[model samples]
Target: MDVRSSAVTIPAGNADLPADLLVPAEPVGVVLFAHGSGSSRHSPRNVAVAHALNEGGLGTVLVDLLTPDEDEVDSVTAELRFDIGLLAGRLAGIVDWLAAERPVGGAPIGLFGASTGAAAALVAAAQRPDLVHAVVSRGGRPDLAGAALGQVRAPTLLLVGDLDEEVIALNQQALGQLTAPAELRLIPGATHLFEEPGTLEQVAEAAAGWFHDHLHPQPARA
Candidate 1:
């Protein structure tokens, strides 16, 4: 599929968020990535998944949830990294910008979040049940989403690594509260970062499939 990439600045209150958007030709949906703690849109794992989604004819938006100054402050005090409400509010701002711009021509939106960003994604989805079509979390701390889990209406897929037992337990706890269609899949022998061979590929595949299923209909089988 033909794809075009661009650097975009989105207005959010007093701040402007920098984002890298990849739009594929004849796209079906757009996936917005919410970065994890100490990570940005430059995360190799998340970028790999975004590439796969692009190949699958989906548009991708990778944006920084925190400003450079905010990240610098968090690097020192470690205060804002876990601020789920703040991050979710930022994600909602981006969603609103996307809706108004309609850059992808009214395509459905999906959220792909990692680590703590997953919690923010859930909160954002809950806040915009009418706008978001689906949500996918990779090695996320859904437990951090708290009461927002029960409010989310989008279909959610929680992907965890077998060796990431702590996060898996957290995911299980969060899964119980989800009234929406939700699934938890464990990638065998994979660690939290999915650094092992072919592990990250599994993450990409599962994410692409989930978004395909929820954001749009399954591609017709050949």
Candidate 2:
């Protein structure tokens, strides 16, 4: 499949975030990535996952959630990254932009969020219930999404590292609060970063399968 990859600026809230957009020919869906704290669009982990999704015929948008200035402030104070409401509003704005712009030409939209960004993704999904089709969280802090978890209508998949017991527990609690179709999967022998050999590969495979199933669902038999 021929893939078009480009650097684009996306308007989210009051900021214009830099993003990398990759769309394969005749994509099944488009997934927007929300990276974790202190991470940008250049995150190696997310880049790897995006590559897998693209190979699976899904378009991907990897955007920096914070502006350069905001990132500088966040680096110093470590506050903005944890500000779930602000991050969620920006993500919602990006969703609106994607919907109106049709960069992927009407492909179903999904979100892949990491760390605190997962909370923002859930909140954005709740805010745009009719637009976001599916969500996947990796080593995510979904509990930070608070009441938005119950409001989210999109099918959500929570992937946690089994060795990261605290996050696994948090994901389990969030899983129970979710009112939509949801599942919690543990990556064995992995920690929060999934840095162990072959572990990140597992994350990519699982995420691709989840998006493919929900974003490109087959028509029901008559």
C-alpha root-mean-square deviation, each candidate? 3.9, 2.8
Overall local distance difference test of candidate 2: 0.93
Least well predicted 10-residue stretch by lDDT in candidate 2: 213-222
Candidate 1 lDDT over residue span 36-75, tens digit each: 9998989998999999999999999999888999999999
Model 2 misses residue 131 by how many Å? 0.5
Per-residue CA lDDT of model 2 for 1-222, tens digit only, reads 688999899998789999999999989999999899889899999999999899999999999889999999999999999999999999999999988888988788999999999999999999999889999999999999999999999999999999999999999999999999999999999999999999999999999999989996334336
List candidate 2 stretches off by more than 4 Å: 217-222
The models' CA-based lDDT, in order, is: 0.92, 0.93
